[model samples]
Target chain A: MEKTNIRTNKNFNKVSDIIESLTINTNPDSVAVLEEIGTNSSIDEVRELTSRALVKRNEHDSLQVVISNRGKGINDMSTIVAMSTINELLSLENKEEAMRVLENTISSEGFDEEVKENARSVKALMALS
Target chain B: MSAIEKVNQLSHRIFNTSKNEQSTSRTSNPFAASNFQKNILTEDVFESSKSKEANKVNFTGNLSASSKRIYSVFVGSINDIGSRISSGIESIKAFGSRMKEGIVNTCVNTWNKIHEIGNKEESLNGTKELLGRDITTFFVNKREREISKMANMNPHMEVKSIFKDALQALEADMVQVA
Candidate 1:
């Protein structure tokens, strides 16, 4: 039991550190790393945390990673995680930046329809609020 | 139809899924998005429940004749539910692409489709609804329900309050832009 508890705590701290660095680290490659690993993790909890961290950073680059990626961020396979990400996006203090990213995602012809449709959902919710 | 096939048929109706048809990609038909759901996502509800055997009900107590008949009917229905579910699970697994995110995506598509059809009110006349609530208003109410569910699952998250504010802000007057 003690071993399991320590292992769990260590994992939790590791995830927290990742999220903290993703938000505070100003390097462009930092966000790139987050997009590649954090969002792409098969675990729903990891993907959800990455999404929240990106939304919390409130930057165009971070927001674009979550909004445009397939099977990640708002496009998560788990409803709870996806909804959680959407909730975080809506809770941002400066909603305009997220709105800008979502708008571009919607109008861009490059994205898959699934991505665009998901973006459209976020836009509708954002528009309402 | 075979009993399993019958059960599969009933499962299709219960899950609101296409019968034996692989769900077309959202790109093919924008409206086919909400195709995945809860039962499809689970690993094996029947097998898990069977192994544990915790959910089995005991109806062995002495009872009057009429009461026993009612109990028999209840037991039959419960057994039917279990069988129908097992068959449905198999059929859904056959459909492939059992992504949980598809559940939310499908909801968005259907919700948007209703509003889109309501806006036209021409060529199709699909705006007709039963309860006198406009399509947009109906959609808001549904989202409100969803927000409540999400909130319960993750009370730490702000999912519920954000959606509540969105619904209240719209006041059901705002139609979703398709």
Candidate 2:
């Protein structure tokens, strides 16, 4: 598990570098360039870049979808990520469904013990309602 | 009872008895040996050099007190803006209703005045007095239409100003955060 974490970290760092390079080289203001990059890049590369950038932006965002997904040192990083996730979820009309997704994500075994415990407390409080 | 259940009950009773004794002891002499040990362990741990170093490291991380203050400020400002915008909308709605009522009242008063004048005198010197009433009514209608149009556009203008202010506030906040 530790080895896999190190590997993921390295991969994320590499992808981050690639994204920074892309951002520097490409015109961010131009939707055409973004669309072109999306179309031209290999499916795996695009997915990896998008996923890693999102993770870099907020690790808990990816975790909210899959409960058991573990990243050791990402708890502090989760707040901004969680806020962004909540913001996105709020944008959708089906807010209750979005909240359910958030709940399920946090409940998953992939989350750290503290996060899981917090989620459990929240669930308990919600159940009281 | 089963052996384990009997043992559990006995242990629980013993624990409860000891806890009661400890509480009684605390009231008499709070700085007793057990209390001293508990205080030393909890308090001294926080005051220790190792704990201080750990805290220093934690403080440098994203969830530091300063970062938390910034996040709190952000959330607070957003909430304030949301509230102000909503209240502004409500105020505009209230203004619209009041304006509508005012226009209706004016129209009703003008009609009453015209009816009273027409009843009082059947004819004027040369031209019909109803023509003057019609011209006044036309001007009132035009003015009401203009007021309605302005009222309809006012919300959009206010919305634009609110958005502009919000963007400015956000930019200033970002600069502060940076």
Candidate 3:
């Protein structure tokens, strides 16, 4: 068991370094690339970390990717990753942009009911905390 | 002449020896006995030195006034040594009390530290403010905030370069994992 942990630690550290690099990229297109790779990534941990990175960006474009994209961010089938993204949204220093995106997702008829519901819940949490 | 007479004679010799010690030395007197002969002459071997020092009358069977003065001086020296030993015992008792004081002070300090550790009011305050986030989340958030600041400061930075940098980072990760 200890040996397995040691082997996985190296891979975990490698992922962390790459994730840090993703957050370091400053261009607007990085958000789209992040949404594409983050939402579609097979690994739940990657999706979770990437979703958080997007929310931390706090830009309208980055906020929309995590808040409205299908099967990504708040819409992730993985409850754990979706919750992680919600927690990040709630924790943002400036909630104005994220709240606007959520209001759009909730009011617009284009989003799935599930995604809108997640947005409403996140909004409620933001109001509470 | 007899056993008792010999003892009396020896004491008489010692008494006169002390009285006229300036002029009549024991070694110079032809009749005075050696320490070895004194031992042989005494009934018990251990009796020689101590019993020899014990006061005996002069040839007249009465102690001289000068002899009493010498005995008093010897008793005074013994009393002085005994008092010094008693003072040493008193000092040891003082040291024991000082040691006890040091132990009490250490116990008090440890008790104060324990109370400081048990204080929970600050933790409760932090919980109310949501300042008690997990350490891993705190570090990740701080890193993302840095990225946000960089993006805001360098508006001219290209989206193409950002993708290129991210692709390079992923490729490096794949190589390492492999």
Candidate maximizing lDDT: 3
Off by over 4 Å in 3: A1-12, B1-178
Measured against the native two-chain assembly using Cα atoms, what DockQ does each of the candidate structures obtain, in the order listed?
Answer: 0.01, 0.00, 0.05
- Which 10-residue window of candidate 2 chain B scores lowest in summed lDDT? B37-46
TM-score, candidate number 2: 0.18
Candidate 3 scores an iRMS of 6.5
- Lowest lDDT block of 10, candidate 1 chain B: B169-178
TM-score: the better of candidates 1 and 2 = 1
Q: Give the backbone clash total of model 1.
A: 3
- Candidate 2 Cα deviation (angstroms), residue A91: 3.5
Candidate 1 regions exceeding 4 Å error are A1-8, B1-178
lDDT of 2 by residue, A1-129 (tens): 232343344333333333433333322222222222321333233333333333333323332432223321122234443344333333343334434644775656665677665445434444444
Q: What iRMS does model 2 reach?
A: 19.8
Docking class of 2: incorrect
lDDT score of residue B56 within candidate 3: 47
Q: Which pairs clash in model 2?
A: A68-A110, A69-A110
Q: List the residue pairs that clash in candidate 1.
A: A77-B101, B33-B106, B34-B106
TM-scores, in order shown?
0.39, 0.18, 0.43
